[model samples]
Structures are given as C-alpha cells and as structure tokens.
Target: MRSLYKIVHTTCQTGWGEQEQRIYNESVWMENKGHQVVIITPMGTPLFTRAKEHGFRVHGVSFKRFSSLKDYGQLKQIFKDEQPHILNTHSKADSNIALPAAKKTGVPCRILSRHISDPVRNTWNNRKIYKQLTHFIFTTSDYTTQHLQQVFKLKDMEIFSMPSGIIPPQDLAPKESARKALARDLCLDATTRFIGFAGTISKDREVDTILKALKLIQSQIPHHIAILGEGTPDCLAELKTLAKDLGIGEKVHFIGAKEDVWPYYRAFDCKVLAPGNKNKIPLEGVPLALLEAMYSSCPVIGSKTCGITDIIVDKKTGLLFDPQKPKNLADMILDTIANEAATLERVHQARELVRKKYTIDAMGRNIIRIYRLHQVKIARQYLV
Candidate 1:
C-alpha cells in the first residue's frame, strides 16, 4: 500500500472550468486513495462550494493582493494548520497569493499547475517569481512546457506534463436511448445525424467557423448540430443570427451550458472542435472536452492547430481538419458520416487510449509520484 500524504490545492477563480474540474477530480481521487486533500478558494465561489459539498476540507480566503500582508497571514495560518506535504496552486491569481504563503510556512513542495498555453513573459520579475516554485505541471506537453523552460530557466525545479483526466461515464444509457432523450428534450429529428460541440461559443471556439462549415455542407448533407455551452447573450444571439443567415437555423440547436454533458455525448454521431482564433501569441491547448467526447465513444473532428494533433493522429484516433477552410471542415464531417466503419474504428482506438492514459486514477498516481520525488529532492538538499 502507498503511504498517504496531505495535499492542498488552491484556485482563485469564481467560475468552474477545466482547471477547477481537474483539481476536483484529482482531489477526490487522492482522498479516496487515503491521502488527505484540502481545497483553498475564495468564499462562495463555485469551486469552494463544490469542493465542500464533495467532502473536501475547504479554506475560503478572499485575496485582494498577492503582496497583502492580511491575505498572506490568513493563508499562512491555513498552511500551518494543515501542514500539507504538497501545496499545489492553479491560475495566476492563486499562485501569486499561495506561493508567498507556502514560502512563509516552509511548505515542503510547491507545485504550479499551468493549464494554459499562454506565453510566460521573460522579465526579471517573472523569473524571480518562477524560481521560487519547485515544480510545474503543464496541461500541454509541447507549447506551454517548452515556452516555460525557455523563459523561466529554473535549474532546480522539475517540470511535468499531465493532461486533465476524464471521469468515466457511469450508468450511461444506450446510444439509441440517449439520442431519443436528446430528441425529446431538444426536439431534434430522430432521423437526422447529429454533430455535437460542447465548449464556449466564443471567438476562440471558432463557433462561427463551424456554423459556416455546416452551411456549406447543408445542401450536400443534412445534419443536426447540438451546441452545449453558453456565452454572453449578445454572442449567443450573433451565432443564432449567423446560423439563420446561412439557412441552418432550423438544423442548429443551442442547448446552453449543461451541468452533465456526458449523456448527450451518446447523442452525437460525430463531434467537431473548430480551431481557435489566432492571437499575436496564440493560446491553445488540448481541450478536456475533446477527451471526454472520446471517452464517451464519440469520434472527434478537431482542428490541426494546437495540441490537438498530440492526441489525434489524423484518421487514427480522430480526424483533423484545417480550420481556416470551411469547405475542408465540411468534407471531414461528410466523410465521417459516409465512412461509418472507419469512424467507429477510430472511436474505439480513442476510447482505449483515453482509458489507458487519461483517467483520474492515472493522473493522481502520476502526480503522487512527482510529489514523492520532490520530497526526496528536498530532503537530499537539506542533507547536503
């Protein structure tokens, strides 16, 4: 049996996205494996409330500033009380506050979970801040990890790549049953093949591009699309209007944000993840949603940009499309429907890959290994 250790995780975000979910999943798994896990968050945030409800020891601290003595005092008190073996902080806000508190309390291991592919600024201040950390766990193996290593140049700290894991779908109804439920709820046509998308309908999501692709293919192939996320009212209205203008308003269904999107995965014949809009310094990573869809046995069509290619080896695990071209996107979708056998084969491969590499248990075990290694390193340093 593995020895248990206390782990403290902090995320200072109000909304619950992939980062929050990753923390929750890993924390639950760690607790179940006999490790003590506590979550620190701002009071009444979704992450704090959910962590509490799920039986985690949660400390709520509203941090005004990273340098605030009051905030530091509160966090230092929590660290002293918990004495966690590992202090893992996610996001810029949480890390800013948590790092100082951990340092003050002499926390054994400091781990930063960098979930985005945003570039790390190569400034003296940024380097100083990063040098204080002992480890980095990046969501992407390629961009974020490489960028940080080049910029931070931390000689002592270890870097790890661990993608967010999927909670295996429990008690998922049969595909036909799920599709029927979706049809009943969303008033979708039973006969129509459904293409699914389950991310924010923002510019980065390229929801507009998907709508345009669907328009190009509508005359060639008729399909229903179920969008299962939310954005601002104006953004949502714009997408709806765009669909209408493309003569696909009737075929497209915006189901808004869903608390449970797993069941609806069964309703999709094929899922599309359009490429993100490029920025000066593009921020992109493998979306956890794509992995979840794969886990649900849904064959995915993802854009070639970003870390998507890391998992999707075009026509192997999933199909990749050029997001810049709407016609290419249309062809990929059409080909997926026409080639059912190939699609199913790809889905099976994806499901197996996810099961092997991307489960909460796998992630927790890998992380625990890193924590142990860090502990050993710290001990060796003290001995020397």
Candidate 2:
C-alpha cells in the first residue's frame, strides 16, 4: 500500500484563490486516485471541513502568517503520528520545520513545492533554509531556477518545474443569467461591454492606469470594468474614487472578495488580470482566475510578466499588452471588441491549450510523479 500526507502550510483556505486552489485540488485528486492524502494547515476549521467536505482527511497545524516556526512543534507532532512516507510541504513555514524534522525522523524523502514566483522578502535567509529540502518543485517554467541554483549553489537539476493546470467546475452556469446579475451590479447598459477582472487587484495592479485609459477608451468605445476580490477597503475605495475623477467612476465597478468566482467569469465577455510583480515576488505561477476564464472560453488579456509568457501566446491563445501602457491595454480591449471573431478564436485556442495542458488530472499526475520518484516504498516480509 502507498500513502502520502501533504502539509499545505499556506495560512489560507481552499477555493479562496491560487495557493488554496492548488492545495485543495491536488489533495482531493490524489485521494481520489487512491492515495491516502491528508492536508496540514493552520486554518484548520475551514480547510479541514472543506477537505472532508470534498472527501479527504485533513490534519491541522496551528500557524502564524509571518512566522513559519509558529507551528514547528505541532508539525513535528503530526510527523510522528502520521509517519508519512514523504513530508511534502507547500508553505515555507512547513519547510522551515518539517524538512529538518523529516530528516531527523528518517522519513526517507522530503519535498518542497515552490508555488510563488516572487522572491520572498526574507529570501536571503530562506534560500539557505531551502538547501535542507530533498527536492524543490516549481509551478511554472519561468521561476528563475538558474538564479536559485546560483543562490543555493546546488546542482542545476536540483530545481524542477511543473506548472499548475486548470481545475474546472462540474457545471457552468447559463450565460444570460450570469450576465444579467453582473450587468445589474455594474448598472451596465446594453451598449457597454463588461470587461471583468477577478482575484487580487491591488494598487500595484496599475488600476489607476486602467482607470486613466478608461477615459480614452470610453471615447472610442463604451465599456465597464469589474475589479473583484477583497483587499484594503480604503485603498479599493480610493481606486473607485479615482475612476470617478476620471469620469468613468460609475463605469468602473469594484466588487469586494468572493467565495465562489465562477459566475463572475460567466458574466464576463473577456477576463483581464493586472496582478503585478513586486519586491522579487512575481505575481504569477498560473493564476486560477485566468485558467478558469480560459476554460469558460472567455477571452483573456493580461500583462506580459513572469510565467505568463509560458501560458499566453499573444494574438494566438490570448492578447498581451504592456503593463506600463494603459493606452495599449485600452486599444487591445477595443481591438478584441471590434474583432470578435479573432478574439473568439483566441478563446478557442486558450481552451484547447488548457484542456490539453492544464487540468488537475494532467498537472497533479506530473507533480505526483516527482513525489513518487523520491517517495519511500517499504517492503514487508512473511515467515512461514
């Protein structure tokens, strides 16, 4: 029999966003594949409940967002109890304590999943800690593995890459109903095309720039933008007010956080993302929102950054625009609207790419392959 216990160390719940989605989907799919999968994380009540809700067992370790060692002891205790053949860690916190403990316990194999492209603020020290891990896993092709190889000074092959594929819902909602609910929220008119964006929309989103471009865009084309997801409310309101100042205030809708974002995608004719790279932390590694939009066959337009190039083939799979040029972004949106057939073709290509390359069944198996390569297989002897 083979079993694996995964410690997702991220201080977040599944279904919320990227990391959560990856953790949840991988664990659930692995369990369905007949592996005894258990997820360890601090947000126990929710993560655990959701895991069981999805038909998998979960182990919770108390964790603090800023401190990786906060759950060190609890994690060690779980390690002893579960006796997982491999200690697979997702969060840096789990790696801080779990990696070394796995070595101490003679767990045989310890692996770390590096889902973030952005450099951690404390990366100087974190790289040193990463050296202890048995293997490193990356979710996208552009993780700067060579840079990490130089910093960690390990073999070039020590770092491995495996990007996250899309995880689609069992059903998609009706198009007209989804559009009605969304259009009503934005008070959008029949003439206005709603360009929707989901996930983290921080100031770094250059949303102000998007708002600025809106003034120019509205002159040529009437459109509404919906920026959804939770964050600093004051900051978000400030962005909305910026829209008002730009005379596109009412046109730019800022809806706060969501538990379920599928309908949001269905409502959108095109999905846009402005996640930015900041402080070495590249806002990347295959965002779930963009993947979901692609599956829905919604046209995707994004800034060319980090792992985005691996997924988006500009003018082929989707359109790419310069992050610094709001005018370019606006023009791309206009072009997409005017060239509906071409934009729709991009959507078709994006969907085919996702169905072929990006999906839980596809990516999970790839990740599982690496985990199994180093996984310990014990033999039992029988005496007659």
Candidate 3:
C-alpha cells in the first residue's frame, strides 16, 4: 500500500513567476496523488490567493527579514497543528523562519528547495541554515547542487538537483495556425515569421542580446521577434530605446506578459534564452521555458552558460551560442532558419528528451520516492 503523506510547502515570494508556479504545480501533483498539501505564504499574495482558491489549506504569514519573529511563531504553531510529514521551504526568507520551526516541532523530512543557480555565500548563518536546519536540500539544477556542495562541503546524498517539470500539452494548435493567430493579435501580416522569447525581462536575462542579434540579421532575414514577458518599466523602456537606436524598433515587439505562452511557443520559428554570464551569481537555472519550447517542437537557442547548457546539448537537442557575442547568437539564429532539415531533426530529439525526462509525472514520482526513503529511515531510527 502506498503511504500518503501530508506535505507543507512555504514560499515568501509574492509574484507568480517560475518558482511560485513550480510550487503550485507540485502541490497540485501531490494532491492528485492523495497527499494532503498545505501552503504558507504572505497574506493577499498571488500564491496565497491561488493556493486558497485551489482549495489547499493555506496560512498567510509575513516572512519579512529580521522581523520574522511573528512569522516564526506562526510557523511553529502551524507545524505543531499540522504535523506534516514533509516540510519544504522555497526561498531564503521563508526557509530561515520555517526550517527552525519544523526542526523544533520534530518534522521528519525538512527540505529547502533552492530554485536559482545563484551563488551561496559560505557564511556561518548560511552554513547553519543549509547544513544544520534542513535534512535534505533540493536544487533546481546540478550546477546549483554542486555549488552548494562546494560551499558547505555537503555530502552528495544530502542534496538533490530536481528541476521543476512541465506537463506536456495535450491539444496544441498547429504551428502555422498558431503563428497566424498570434500575428493577427499582434497586428502583423500572417506571413510574418517570429523568433520568440518568453521569460522575465531583466538585465540578467539578457534580452538585449536577442535584440542585438536580431539587429544583425534583420535586413537579411526580415523577421520579427516577439518578447512575451515583462520587466520593470525602466528596463522595458531601456530595451525599447536600444531597439530604436539599433534601427530595429519595428522589428521588436514587446508583447509583455501573457496568461498563455504556449501559443507563442508554438508560433515561434525559434525560441531563445540569452542569460548573461557576467554576474557574480548565476541567474539561470534549468529554465522551464526552454523545456516547454522543446516539448512544443520549437527549435531552441540558448547562451552556453549556467543551466541553459543542461538542456541545450550544443547542436544535438538544441543550439547554443556564446552570450558574450551577439554575432554568435545571430549566426545560430540564421543557422536555425537556414537549415530546415537539421533544425527539425534537433526539435524532434529535444521533444523526445522532454517527454522521457521532464514531465511533471516524472518529477512527482521521483520526489515521492525520496520521501518514502526518508520515511523508512525515520521508522528504522524510531525502532532502534
């Protein structure tokens, strides 16, 4: 018989980005598999509201830094009341409060999920939080797991690199149809070819790299790039200015954030992720967008850095280019456009990889296996 576990997930983030979406999707997966799932987030936040609407038991606590005494108290109480078999914290602020509460309340399986590839400083506080407070750590990518191992000198078994998985779409519109629909919405001609980017619009994301690459090939290729996400107003303005200055403003369409991006992925001639590598802390994890794009049978191009490399296998599954060089990206985009047979071959390979490994079912089952292992270990300890 399968043992059903009550799992409590905590995240401090208010935004509905990839991390929050992962938590929600995982919670839904857990629930469907007969587990009782609880969410703890700040009151009135998007996650809190969404979880509540989805009929999960939710507790709202302000996870503010340094003044988290109230948050800690509330979490400790919730831990005692809920007695969850697994307590998973998703962000630093939430982890700081919730892990200790779980520890004091004797939660058997405490986990801290690190979602980004950002570098972790080896501070005493960090050491205690990562190594002492949590029983196991879940990172979104191997790069992050290895980085944590180096910083904390953690054993290999103590950390798991489990990227959030996607549910492969069942009924997607045909590529040409999707393209024509998107073109109509964007007020472009049905024949217009689109290169697409669907992620947060930030400096670290390096959307400008795509713009620069587009500028390089615009005259020759005569294609438009649809950016299907938003950023801070300043960032958006700056990008628009850069596009204008490069004389490709008309070619770049900032579609802002969309409720449904799968259509955009389907509409794309090729999808790109171009996160820069200059930051001290790496920002990209195994990006879910790229996985979705690949599963959509869209050809993908990514900067050869961070977790982007984990999915795009040079020229096999997808193409990669140096983020530092716009020409490299331009050349790769041109290659994807020019080589129809090669690009389609890579797209098929990429889709197969996603179906085999990157589905939500795969991730949920693996995580359940980990939970069961810990449950057995705890039982043995109790018997002893």
> Which candidate ranks first by lDDT, i.e. highest?
3
Q: Residue 35, candidate 2: how far off, in angstroms?
A: 0.7
Worst 10 residues of 1 by lDDT: 132-141
Clash pairs for candidate 2: 118-281, 118-282, 119-280, 139-163, 230-257
Compared with the true structure, what per-residue lDDT tens digits does model 2 show for residues 276-376? 66874566676666887888888898887766667789999998887778888888888888998999899899999988878888887776666655542
lDDT of every model, 2 decimals: 0.81, 0.70, 0.91
Ranking of models by TM-score: 3, 1, 2
Q: Per lDDT, what order, best first?
A: 3, 1, 2
lDDT of 2 at 92: 62
TM-score of each: 0.94, 0.85, 0.96
Give the clashing residue pairs of candidate 1, or none: none
Off by over 4 Å in 3: 278-280, 382-384
Better of 1 and 3 by TM-score: 3
Relative to the true structure, candidate 2 has a C-alpha RMSD (angstroms) of 4.3
Q: Candidate 3 at residue 209, lDDT?
A: 92
Give every collision pair in model 3: none
Candidate 1 Cα outliers beyond 4 Å, as residue runs? 154-157, 280-282, 382-384
Regarding lDDT, does 1 or 3 come out ahead?
3
What value of lDDT does candidate 1 attain over all alpha carbons? 0.81
